[model samples]
Target: MPKALSEHETEAFRERICDCAARLYVEEGPAAVTMRRIATDLGCGTMTPYRYYPNKESIMTAVRTRGMHRFSQVLEDALGSPGDGRTRSRAVRDAYIAFARANTATYRLMFEYPEPHKDDTAYREAHERMLRTVVAHVDVMIDEGRIQADAPIFGHQIWAALHGAVMLEIAGMLPPGFDAASLHTRTVTALIDSARPPAP
Candidate 1:
């Protein structure tokens, strides 16, 4: 009998499976991302992927989770640089847009396609953690007296604006002569401006 994989090795193997599955998802849509296909691509027996992931939904969850983990780190590093609240907010917004554009396939797989009625606990929690990261920055703005709104509400507004712009750009729906990067910067600026206290 073969020796069982160590914990670390198991995790690495699982990530490999998710990587293949995610690529197949992006290249051929969700229908082509079957466990057997992943196993075949990985040169393993059909049961191998099944052992790691019970079904396509679980693999999709893993793919989404991996994308979220990497994206969360990008947001962290972007906000880690020395800056004021406004500067940090702008950095975070730009980082968000960059992540979307660079990882268009993974981004679309994560958001554009939905897996309904599936137990996506890890994906949902990772999503909330990303939101909390944004909220923390908004809290900084509020505490600095730069904004006059609920931090969570304002954070969500920032997310909404960024998401809309990125999605529109990705779908090629932006108008001719429209500059997405400029629009992204302006959108973040406008959100901050909206939160500013009116001049007395």
Candidate 2:
């Protein structure tokens, strides 16, 4: 009989499976992620991954949920930094790109892949928390007279612009000689400039 794994070993093995699945999904897209493939990548029995995750979708959900939680932490750290509105905004923007660059595959999968199950509370709550963080930051800016727009609407607008730039960079669609960091800085600055209250 196979030796039983200790609880810590079981949890570590589960994380390894999820990490491998996440990388596969990011590198080869959703169709390439499978329970058997994950088990093979981890050098385990074909049934090992299935014992932890019922199917490929469950593994995907776990990956996505973990991504969301990490993302929320990034945003939270940015929001908590000591700074004025523009400073905080810049920190958030930088953090956003840093996360994407550091975890390219997982970041892409988080935004591009659809959840296999709609009822995954962990994924839903984690995603919602990230948005709420953005909204809270927007509220702070508005209170400081830094932003002149609806908090949620403006926050999502900023997110869209940042996401678009990051996606283009990831897809290699940006023009040759384009400096992504500079472009991102200019894009963010322009948006902030446009949102400022007009002078009397």
Candidate 3:
């Protein structure tokens, strides 16, 4: 019998599986992300991946869940940093773009790909954590009297702008001389300024 993997080894292997699966899904489409394909790419027996994930759908979920957790962590770190409301919000914006650029496949997996299991607890929790972090940043601006809009509404608006800019960047749809970072900065600044209370 093959020796059982240690806990650390098991987690390492699982992460490797997720990484491979995400790459395949992005490059070759969903039809290419099969257990046999993953095993072949990893140079393992066809049955090896099944030991870690029960099916293709579960593997896809794990890939998305992992991406969501990492994405949330990036945003949360930016939000937790020492800065005023605008400064921290800018930090969060930078973090979001950096994460998407660095992990393009995973970013697409998390947001663009169809979810394998909408009811998956891990995905839901990670998504909620990300949303809360965003709203909390807006709440900071509200607390500082910098903006006078409902937190959730303003937060969603800001998020939509950021996501739109990022998606365009990913798709190479932005016009020449207009990068995602610059566009995002301008967009976010406008959104925030628009919410400012009128001066007396």
Candidate 4:
């Protein structure tokens, strides 16, 4: 039997578990992370995390959902300023990279490491909402005839490319002498170039 977590304890443990998992995932990998390990890392006694989550899978699920929710904010804020779709689109990429950089552990766990497939309705909904928001932006270009009929694919293409670039950069896969900001700018620029129609 596990000790019960109070309201404050729940939130605190939740955040702590996520933080510890993130650090561990980044430093090691998801396989190396355990509920007991997280509790240990956070200086909590064993069985503490179990009170909050049933197991590591649940923790990963929580992390994934939180990652998606955080990503939606990044996408929304990226398009804040008034600009051409191309520029605003880069803002979206920038926001995404920022999120990846700031949340390296979450980003790695969400992408690089593998987790069991679960329906995760909340994760799916948040991810879909993010996609729709971005696709809607691309749809504008499509409706204006600034993009091809397959603009939805273009939207995801840009997102996938950005994710790869951000992941590689964060994972230290990029070669030396390359500035991260420059790489980010190039990724954003390339995606925009490929996705956006030529200027009149």
Among the numbered candidates, top TM-score falls to: 3
Report every candidate's CA lDDT. Answer: 0.80, 0.81, 0.89, 0.72
lDDT of 2 at 139: 79
TM-scores of all predicted structures? 0.81, 0.88, 0.93, 0.78
| Over 4 Å off, model 2 | 1-12
lDDT of 4 by residue, 127-199 (tens): 6776676565676556666566476787777667667667678768877876455666676566655655567
Residue 15 in candidate 4 has what lDDT?
76
TM-score for candidate 2, please give it.
Answer: 0.88
Q: Which stretches of candidate 1 lie over 4 Å from their true place?
A: 1-9, 117-120, 173-179
Regions of model 4 farther than 4 Å from truth: 1-9, 133-136, 143-145, 175-177, 184-200
Clashes within 3 Å, all models in order: 0, 0, 0, 0
By TM-score, the better pick of 2 and 4 is 2
State the weakest 10-residue window (summed lDDT) of model 2. Answer: 177-186
Position 73, candidate 1: lDDT? 82
Per-residue lDDT tens digits for candidate 2, residues 57-120, read 7878887888788887997899789989778877877788899988887788788867766577
Q: Indicate the TM-score of model 3.
A: 0.93
| lDDT value, residue 126 of candidate 2 | 81
lDDT of 3: 0.89
Number of the candidate with higher lDDT, 1 or 4: 1
